[model samples]
Target: MINSIKTPNRLVNEKSPYLLQHAYNPVDWWPWCEEAFAEARQENKPIFLSIGYSTCHWCHVMGRESFEDQGVAGILNRSFVSVKVDREERPDVDAVYMAICQALTGQGGWPLTLLLDTKKRPFYAATYLPKNSRYGMTGLTELLLKVSELWKTSRNRLLESGEQIVEAMREQDRTGYVQEPEKNLLYEAFSAFAHSYDSRFGGFGEAPKFPAAHNLLFLLRYAKEENPAASEMVLHTLDGMYRGGLFDHIGGGFSRYSSDEKWLVPHFEKTLYDNALLVMAYLDAYTQTKEPLYRHIVRKTLDYASRELTAPEGGFYCGQDADSDGEEGKYYLFIRQEILDILGENRGRRFCEWFGITEQGNFEGKNILNLVENANYREINPTMEHCCEKLLCYRARRTFLHKDDKCLTSWNALMITAYVKAYLILEENQYLDTAQKAERFLEEKLSRDDKLFVRWREGVSAGYGKLEDYAFVVWAELMLYQAIFDIRYLKKAVRFADTMCDRFFDDTEGGFYLYARDDERLILRPKETYDGAMPSGNSIAAYVLGKLFKITGEEKWRERSQKQLRYLAGSSGRYPAGHGFAMQAFMDALNPSQELIALSPEQEDLRKLRKLVAAKPNLTVVVKSPENGQELAELSPYTKEYPVTAGHPQFYLCSGNSCAASVDTLQALKW
Candidate 1:
């Protein structure tokens, strides 16, 4: 008989929710640390490393199937120094091993299973092994026994293979790739996206459509440069997603991705990054087309984040799980009778018809809400909002999915950027306030020695900041400065930019490394450039440097940004869809928007100019009172002689160290 008693492992004392979830497993799991490595070395055992986050469905499945099983646990405990790592906490570790896994197997994903030597170099890698051999794949128990035999017999070959893999990755990193950051790069990206564009269903590729939001941002910028097709693709995808089941009609945010091309079904997991990136995309769409639908989407997404994913301490949580009560999408799906019970017969039937809710449900015998069938639901029922509120209230009483409440610096930065952008476009003070609160929380809780850390939870912060953390937070600070015209924020941006250079920048090579040079645990420091689910550190760093150059008028900033762009140009041109943010950064570097400074103590023109800047979409406007001219002069020396004329605010269009004559009327302002 299987043992019913729970055995607490080393993970019981760990802080990560993912690790804590595995604390009661029969397998003696160790948290990723020097102590774990030391034990592996002392015992002369191979380290079995498992990397995943708390919200991952497959991670949970693997835990239940293999980790919780007594037989599988016995094999692992006897043969390997099993270690559990939360990918979100140590993304640097994940990046290095994931690259190795991809190299070994030509693909990689979580829950990442790797067999490493005592020195932490991976010798074997795979993802999600079952308890027993099934579906023509190796089982965890069998794999463990085989690995144990190999360790006893072929240990030399295994160590040699690990050494060779590490060397090859290092050699690959040393490759000096450079290309021109020209307008043609943007054209190439647009061409690639156009070729992959799904004319019928919207979005790129086949079934399993991911919301690669940076691609939309790139296309939106591309459309302005005389590419109407790009804009059409973006708008179609946005509208398709808005009407599809991938969007929570009851809740406010998007799931991680749609499982099918039609977006009728989703993976059911909601990540803070996806929602945050979607908000930016919708805001960009609203800016371009002034579409009310885009505006509504932005509002709904932000509201969902605020209501569900936000923490009590003003920081945002990581994500929500796909499964609830051991059933996938249970909390979200509804039966036809349930809709009738909640909304009554007349309205319920109409709601059912509109959302494609039938007795024969779209997913697992229950309807997942969607507007795919009745696209004109709003026209059919004007009281749709009230009905939705009623359904939402009822649904709230159900068992909610597990949420990952760890507030990450990089993820929080992305959300904060979205909030700042929302405030800029919508002119909502609450958005601005929310953005400021998150930034303040990050600053106070996740920072030490004037540097930001990776994860914060339950008043404890650990892990040094990665390159993305510094780059994204700098982007956030710049956005905050643009919205509020706070010199302190701008100065902080410059400070973090400097710190990023010191910590992550590759002096000999051009791109930034994913981890700090001083981080000793990493076998090989990976220099990542391709934008995956989120923008890469190199991409955001180049973007940040380009904006910093424009803001500070520093030649060093321009030179560094150009160098970084040159390093990224090859990937940006060759695989445009993969490097969407990098392409956008390249475009920004090529033709940066002119900086507009509205020098006035008067509130009216400054507000008008700020709104105009928002509407214009390409200009970065800075507003300051003439009374604080000395402060502006100290912060930015170029604005020293500029003054408010005749007690009325004046607008100066400045580009590349030259400012035009001050203009009073908005019509006289030059682009």
Candidate 2:
């Protein structure tokens, strides 16, 4: 119930889509800044901090139910200094505060609500709240009044509680000791995943299943080295996800996650990171098992990204919202009569049978359009493809879906790597071209003075880069170097890695911090290791460092990667399943890995050798031609002694610190 004549708030000046959505609310919302804290201190009032992203559905619900209400706004304006933050733009702030919420409430999610003192230490934390009390939940207005009363009457106690929480967090951060991970940690991680896996449904555990693509990537690596049975779980889960509503079969991208164990109903928000990581998972599946379905899924997912999420400047956008026209899932849902009218009688009936679009729908009396009911869903035909294309076009004209158009550096880097992987595995030059274009986009727009920024939108870049930005951009460069055997990309990766180490790496401790040393200081600096929907910054840092060490034979890279692995081992040993990406990095460190250096003048020979190495997941390859040999020698000094040949490529294969003699042909190498 906003005022009839609404005055714009401080959020009107911000660029975040989430912040802009609340620009006209009756509640005076201040974007996160020093001025908000100064106002809170001057007024001697607690701060109400709300953190969420634009595409989050519950955030929208909370906005309508509480933030727009006149009564709730009055209490928030009079008694507390209200602040709004888009978590995507300020993940450093979100990470530190989210740890507090999870510690206090035993769970955490978006529309994150916290009552904090002027010092910015949180005392009270919760998720979504209604304006009026309902369903046994506390009303936002009542909660505000109670907290205001406590601030006046029991001020000292509240301050002391906040101080204690901050101290406890500091203490927890100081508890870990650096130690090399045990050799059996990989087996332990595999056992954890195996125990929780749902044999029938394919995903792990119960309802509300996220894609968790990093876990599947780890399993693929583990299946290659140790247990072959690990692959069954990966294959089953991949097929199950594609067949269910979690994947948009017609539209060609995946939703956020499945709301049920059957994977039939999804949350319906499409994100760039989820699709990027899933593409890598599917590409690896295709490489290891040679499955056509996995390759098809990869192509479809990448095509979807190219069509929808990509910006005109070549960088990928953050995500698409779940709601359309003020209703969740409205853009995706369809009734039987609408489909029949759109496709006509025979083709419509066939499409309905194949995609589970029935008279009685599976969700809210409308079809979600899944292939869970079809036995031959993987077998594609021309008729099915044409009908889906027609339906997709019709759906686009029928509803308005909101897209978050901000380009995040870390997510765009992840997508770049996905495109590179697709190019390598599928031999599509367009994929490589797309990746190179995104790299140029990030370099031109997001990078300034050799340091990356967090986001860029509408020609304005803001916020300093975090660990994920540096780490993933380095990863993208490494992938680019591997795809094309370019010296410039390798040099660029090394330069960024040096900058990353200088800015975020903890020399005294082990892992990298979420934010840089010069970034704004929060209540407590956090170093995260858990791999959730996406891999953590430390995990990717460890992984790319390990790859660089293998490629360059640099002791500094090896030492840093080992230190990070030790830190991750200490943090993740108790619950190894939660740190999938960290374990994957550790596995790379522990396994018998090969480095194949191809010395030749012919580009065709180098290409064949690159494909051979790409097929083997554990092998790292570098190309040394007469033209680039001197440059390669400067980066990888070991390549200096290897002689370049004229007609065919001479391969120098090194496995676990031992080198075999150079071979003339692929048959002679006996790989």
Candidate 3:
């Protein structure tokens, strides 16, 4: 019995919250490192690799059912070298193995279970399993025993399988061919999205709907450039998500996703990236339609991020757990009686009516507040706002919500971009300040010697910057440069982009690798193009490179962007909807893009031009004053040619290879 030894395992020393959660397990668990693999080799035992995040509900479930059980732990301790990984902390490891799991099982998810040989190549892979066999599913205990028996009897066969999986993965990576993206690919992607469009519920497909904000972003571009009809789908999905329980009407953010198509019941985890991307989507919607509702949602979601997920050092935290007090959604779920007791009869009844709160309840005899049934809920009222504030306060007192305080550079960069977009669109000064502050936090904490790290928690930063981190930080810096017209941000962006190319770019294959070349080498290097929940690193790299090429007119950047786009074109051709962000990048590559250089000695004129540029999705702007003209020139050498007029601002509009005549007035510059 493993539980007989009360001492903690190796995971007790790990900084990751997910690893720390398993520190007290009866089974001895090792954090992913060289020592664990060395031990596996020495002991001649197969490695049991488990990958999951802290907020994942099923990760918690499996931990409770198997890892914590003495009998199961005994079996694992005897036969295998158990290693745990927080997928968020080490996405590079997760990506390589998750691909293996999917290739082997045709599916992938959290609480990933795998049996690997001493070399770390997976021979067996599956997602969740119980302690004992039930419901036609093999249990963890039985599986572990079987694998142990196989390791002793058929060791060669197991090693051969591992070798085959690795070779096959390498072959699959090599099989990708570069194809020139055609204009028709955009239409093909649009058609795929239209096919899966959930006409009634606002998202695509069936149950468990994710707020794929990148998909909406791609559709927005399509609507603007191609068909006006595409916009309705975006609007409907945004509205549907807002009205559903997927959105936290009382507390202000969105949950991870919904369990049903109508968006009624959510999994209740509130992630920083989801909120950040959703904010961008809503802000773009507001800009497109001038819809006040979209604006409201953007503000509320940002406010929620600031209030709940933000660290005092100005970096955003990872997410909040879906479970509280060992029960899923306990902190979020509300009883009708509790609502009535908190708000009194009249106000409570009205509040309950507006939000779909009923005595019968929608989830496990508790209510998840939503406005799906109420059409007039959009009407602003002081009483409803006040009631929500009171309920928020009361909910805090009732139970505790677990917050994942680790700040990831990629997710924080995404929020920084969201805040910048909000500031530009809403003309909010605080949003700009917030964006700049968070960028400063990243530069100070998560970066070392000009190299970005993946995560920071409790004064310790770990993991070399991955493709997502570098791409997103470049994106954030570019956005900040546009927001404040600061040469420093643009210069930093250029430097980081250069470093990113040196470290992660695959010269022969054409896409960025998930992990840098200098970082730890896993079983196989992965280049992910499929956008799941968030935009893939290659997609963002393609996007920022295109923007860099346009703004700076750097031939290197243009070549890199074109190469990345061609690589993506090959992957996205078969299933374009899945590569929504890459498709958006391709759209940018195909469309007529304009870069506007606004130069003025007067600050007011430059300020007005900033707003104008923000409204035009196709336009990239760089503002220059006589004071910082030299600095601007260093970042964008072409900008040095555009002279700053003393009183009137000069605008140089460049599209394709041609430059328009300088126009002093904003109205004279044709969009």
Which lDDT values do the candidates have, in the order given? 0.86, 0.90, 0.90
Cα shift from native, residue 365, model 3 (Å):
1.1
RMSD of each: 2.1, 1.6, 1.8
Error of 1 at 630 (Å): 3.3
Q: Give the per-residue lDDT digits (tens) of candidate 1, residues 1-671.
A: 12338657888888899999999998899988899999999999999999999999899899899998889889999999999999999999989999999899998888999999988988889988888899999998888999899999999999998888889988987765788888877787788889989988899889889889988988988887648779999988887887898889887799988989988899999999999999999998999888777888898899999999888889999999999988889989999999998899999998888888999999979999998777573352447767888888998898988999999999999999999999989988999999999999988887766588999999899999999999999999999988778787888888889889888887765889898877655898878988878999999999989888777667788888888988888656667667889877877767656888777636666566667756654577766675566766765676776665547867788776577898876668877
The per-candidate count of clashes, in order, stands at 0, 0, 0
- lDDT at 262, model 3: 89
lDDT of 3 by residue, 45-90 (tens): 9999999998999999999999999999999999999999999999
1 against 2, candidate with superior TM-score: 2
Of models 1 and 3, which has the larger lDDT? 3
